[model samples]
Structures are given as C-alpha cells and as structure tokens.
Target: MANDEAAIKSYLAKYKHRDFTTREVMSLIQVYRSLTYRLEVFVFNNGTRKNLLNLEGTIPVTYKGAVYNIPVCIWLMDTHPQNVPLCFVKPTADMTIRVSKYVDSNGKVYLPYLHEWNPNGSNLMKLVQSMIAAFGELPPVYSKPRNEMPMPYPPTFPTTFPHPQYPSQPGPTFMPHVRPTAEMPTYPNFGLPYPHPGTANGSQFPTPANPLPYPTFNYGSSPEVAGGTITEEHIKVSLLSAVEDKLRRRLNEQSQQSQAELETLRRTAQELQEGKMRLEDILARLQKERSDLDKNITILQEKEKELQSAVERLGEQEGVDVDEAVVTTAPLYTQLMNSFAEEATLEDAIYYMGEALRKEVIDLDTFLKQVRTLARRQFTLRALMQKCRQKAQLAC
Candidate 1:
C-alpha cells in the first residue's frame, strides 16, 4: 500500500535541521512491528569519523507459494537523506541463493526503488515498504531443510532404569579414530526390536579385505558416525573457507567506509579554510580603522598647538592699553596713548605698567574701573559710526 508512489520527497522534515536520533530512525522503519536498528560510530584508518546506522527487519513476503517473513538489512550512509541508503535482502537460511528480482543469495537486492532514491521523497518507511512489495514477488528460493544443521553423528546412550530389560554399557566408549563426514549419521529407531547382540554381528562388521581410512573400534552395537572410525586429525575445511570468505567481504565493506570518511574530512577542511580567510579579512579591516583613528587624533593635537600659539601672540599684541590700566598719572596715560598712536605693540606697555603697578602708582580697583570704561567707550564709538553710515545711505 505504501508503494507505487509518484515521487520521493523528504519525510520527517522536523528532524532535517539535525542528525536523526536512533529512536527517530527506528520509528521511521517501523521498529516495533517488523524493523530494528542499531547506531555505530566508525573511525577510519585515515583519521576520519562517520556516524553509521545498521537496520534490519522482516517483511511479509510470498515466496514459492508460501507467505514467509523475509529478513532484510540496510546500511545508512553518513549523509543519509541527501544520499541513498544501501539496501540488502538477507538469505532465508544462510545458504547461498539468488533470485531474478530484488532478492539474491548474497542478500543483495537489485530494485528500481533503491536505484531511483530521491531525497525529496524517499524515506525509511517508504523504502522498506517498497522492498517488502518487491520481495513478495518471487523471492530467492530456499528449502526449510536447508536451515537444519547436518548432524553427521549424534551421541546416544543405553537407558538403565528399574526395568531390568534395558541394558547399560559398562563405560563411555567410542570409535575415537573415526571421523565424521558430509554424510548423514545413521540412527536406529528405538521402538524397533533388536536381535540378541551375540548373533547380530559378523553380518554388520567389515572384513580386512577392504581397508577404511580410519581404525575400527565400535562404541556400541552399531557406529553410525562414519562407515569406519573417527579421528581427531580431521578438520572442517569447508567451514573454515566460509569464514575466510566472510572476513574478506567485511574488509571490503570497511574499505568503502574509509573512503566515505575521507570525503567528509575533505569537505570539513575546505569549510574551515574559508572561515579562516573571512576572519583574516575582518581583522585587516579592524586594523585599518584603528590606524585611521590614530591619524585623526594626531591632526587634532597639531591644530590645538597652533591655536595656543596664536592666542599667546594676540595677548602680547593687546598688552596693557592706557585706558585698560589704572589712570594713576596723566603723563603716563599720555605716553601710553602716544605709544598706541605710534602702533606700538602691547608687550612693551605691559612691561612698563608692571613696574608702575608694583610701585603702587596704579590701584587694582582703579585698574578694573578703567578697563570697564574703555569697553563702554568702544561701544559708543561703534554706535556713532553706524548712525553716520545710515545717514549717508539715506541721502543717496
């Protein structure tokens, strides 16, 4: 029902701003119902990191006229939504098998849904649903018998109970030199009546004409593990080969993960470099601004010095006019006025008046009164000049 979608788009968008939590990702896969997930942080050989997720679940699939719960797994990449999650269909019983559709003996699924995964519309829920639908259509063929472990030899013992008819072996004896093989171990039905042990032999035993690879030592009346005897020297070479193959596949997967981590590190380094350049530019601007402020302050200080020098010169030129000094002596005042008419600077007058003032020839109160009277006289002169100018203009 979840399949046959027109487009793939982002679902659970509320979590887009941040990496999805394990719980959130599991829920999207329908964890409680038929899905499960685990989080893993991987550090690669190149000193890069990745937050990976392993997801597995069962889907209701119809396979070879039987409805079965087919197991599946998915590998979520670092940039999950922005990239496609690697999907796999697990073999039913672990025996190597492959199907024409999405199901394969190696648990590799080839499906359009996964191939066309779009970040805008694809989500865990939709992806799983699509997988379930594809798997339902002729999944990898496997038999229930394929699931049963081969019991080449199952150990058995005689019962010793209150019933005297049951016989017990004196001790635990075995054909230790006999080795088990791929052949199925024979087991006699306990319900069947057995012939008396005294005469049953000779027919069941082998002669010296045909030699077996193992020594002949009977554990019980019948040894079913092998045609002959079992030995400790034998090894399960097939099982070991299977294990080695699995290790190689795991190493391959690790290589892919390492490559992905390297890519992420490359992007991170580029961003850091860009940010550092931007900060350097900002720092340069700040330095320029600081230098500009220093120059402005230096110019203001130079202007202040020039203004002070001009004020000192003006004060020297305006030194102690006769009217501004106390009018202590008429001759001194006449001399001061004569000096002013001659355009004499105030510096010389201040020198001469200092001696007069110190000698008490001029009083402090009279000095201040003379300065005020001079200010009033300047104001009256300016007013008369302005009135004459107005009269001249009226005549014109």
Candidate 2:
C-alpha cells in the first residue's frame, strides 16, 4: 500500500494541479481495484507528445439485466481537473466497437458529461459513474464468437438488476467485455427491467404470459458429416485464429507505445541541444569579459609602477626647499623671484606688528609707523617685480 501510494505520488508529481488530482486519483483507485495507473506519453492530434498519467481498466456497466465490465483508458493531462481527460474504449480481440452517440468508430468516448465538464464539480469518480450510466444505456462494444457466424444476442430474462456502483465492491457480478451479438437492448435506467422494444406494448420484464423466445447453441453436441466430424480440426483452427488475433493486437499496441516513446526522446534531445547552445553563448560572453578585464589590469599595473617611481624620486629630494629648487631661466626672472620674495617677507613683518599692537606689546602709534615703513619698501619691491616679469615676457 505504501509503495502504491508512493508510485501514484511520483506519477502525479508533474501534474499542474497535483494536490486535488492526487486526491481524486487516490479515491478512484481505492474504489476500482481493476483500474491501474501509469505515467506514459500521450500524443496529441497536432503531433505533440507529453508524458501524462493514464488510468486504464474496466468500469462495470449494467446492460439489460446483466452487469458487464467495459474496458476503458482515461488519460489525464498535465492540466487535469482544469481540463477534461481524454477517454477511449479499449475493445479486445473478441470484441468490436459499437459505434453510437457515446462512442465513435475509433473507440473514442463522447458524452454530455465530458462536454460540459466543470473543474469545480466534475471529478474522476463522478466521471466514471456517468460512463457507467451512459454505457449501461448504450453499450459501446459487442463480442464476437470465435470461428462462428455472428448470432443475435440471447434475450436476457429480467432478474435482480445490478446498479452502477463501485467496481471493487462485490454487490454486482460483472462479466468481461464479451457479448454474443451485435444487436443489444438498451436500458431505460440503471437497475431497471429489460424492456423488449419489438413487443406490441413495450414489455418491461419477461413473464410466462409474455416470455422472450431466444435460441440456444449447444457446442458440446457434435454434428454428423458424411466424411468424419471435423470438430477437432475446426477447434484447432479456431484456437490458432484467436491466438493470432490476440498477438496482432498486442503487437500493434507495443508498436504505438514505442513510437510515442521515440517521439518523447526526440523532443528531449531537441531541448537539450537548445540549452547547450544558450550555455555556449553565455560562456563565450564571459570569456570575452575576462579578456577585457585582463587587459585593463595590465594597463593599471603599468600606471601604478610609473606613479611609484615618481614617489620614490620625490622622497629622495625631501631635504631640498621646493621654492629654491626652481632655477630662473634668465637674469630678469632671477631678479623677479628675489623681489617677489622680499615683498612677501615685508608683508609678513607688517602683519606681526599689527598682532603686537593688538596684544599691547607695542603701542598703536609704534605699530602704525613700522607698518607704514614696511609698506613703502614692499610697494617698491612689488613694482620692481612687475617690471622684471614684463621684461621676461611672463604673466604678472
């Protein structure tokens, strides 16, 4: 049970609506013991293949007054519950699909229940119930007798009719998808009496007064022929034919499954190729950026070496006065530098005399006289510096 639950979880992991889908599926599988779930690739009409969850098994349908199990496969899309599942009838070798309003020639089922499926209301259990009710009304397939001419179905006597209920529950005894004939009667409602339509008045049940006359075949009785009975040889040939038909059907199913898997592999390969191309593109861009960064680092390293060399040379000349280190280009420039120095010295002396006066170290009158004298000499030096600069063709 744990393994089954785990397997179901793994299969439904890819579903878009996993929570509700899992709940519905668990409920369905618990009720229908014959039904099994698998994750397989389902191909669309447009040639798109997707790995979807498939629940395949027989749903018990009450036909006439007897219960028959109808083989069906339900495919849930990735968007299941939100979207209606793809349903189909699977007829075996001994059965042929009966084309009707509910089922098509290809064994695809169609009904108002599926047509008007509501995500909020429609569920797998209810869907199966609807199928049971619908198929009970009009059976989708009829069985064929092996190696014999087709005969009309024997009229079933009305007895305890089986209701459409859970398949796992043992209230109704169900038969396989094998009916003897093509012409089958329809039930007005589930668990109702078998009504013969051909009767003068629609007879609901067979009675001694209105008994249904049906022919019975005795296979045990051998027919006498002029040349010996061919029953043994006929039986052998019939078994061979049945085996061949069963093998052919199995082979066809295997081939289709292989084809779908091949398509899925091809799609996966295509996606992987696309991903590789994108990754290659990103790698190339990263390499180019790395190359650019390397070149920039080399350039910055060269600039750092040049700056370090300049700093080292400056450190060696730390003892030299920066102003005196300037060598005048001509005699007039030399005189201009000297006069500018003297004028700056006089301005400093006058600033100190004003400070002394503020501190009362010198009288205001003494400070004024000293500042006036220094100012007169500073003014003369500044005029001489301007003249020397003009003579040297330098800005004043």
Best TM-score among the predictions, by candidate number: 2
Residue-level lDDT tens digits of model 1 in 1-396 = 133011112222233423453334645644324455544443433344554565655555543333445555565655567656656554322222333435432345556776677666777777776876776564543322333553332355222101100011121111211225544222212232222112231112223343321122222343333433333322333244346545544674576578779989999999999999999999999999999999999999999999999999988885677556656345544444444443333344545556777799998786556546655655554455455445445321
Number of clashes in every candidate structure? 14, 0
| Per-residue lDDT over 281-347 for candidate 2, one digit per residue giving the tens place of the 0 to 100 score | 9999999999999999999999999999999998987598868779987778788888988998998
Instruction: Write out the backbone clash pairs for model 2.
Output: none
Whole-structure CA lDDT of model 2: 0.66
Range of the 10 consecutive residues with the lowest summed lDDT in candidate 1: 160-169
lDDT of each: 0.47, 0.66
lDDT of 2 at 366: 89
TM-score of each: 0.33, 0.40
The regions of model 1 sitting more than 4 angstroms off are 1-32, 41-49, 99-106, 140-396
Candidate 2: segments with Cα more than 4 A from true spot: 148-396
Q: Deviation in angstroms for 340 in model 1?
A: 12
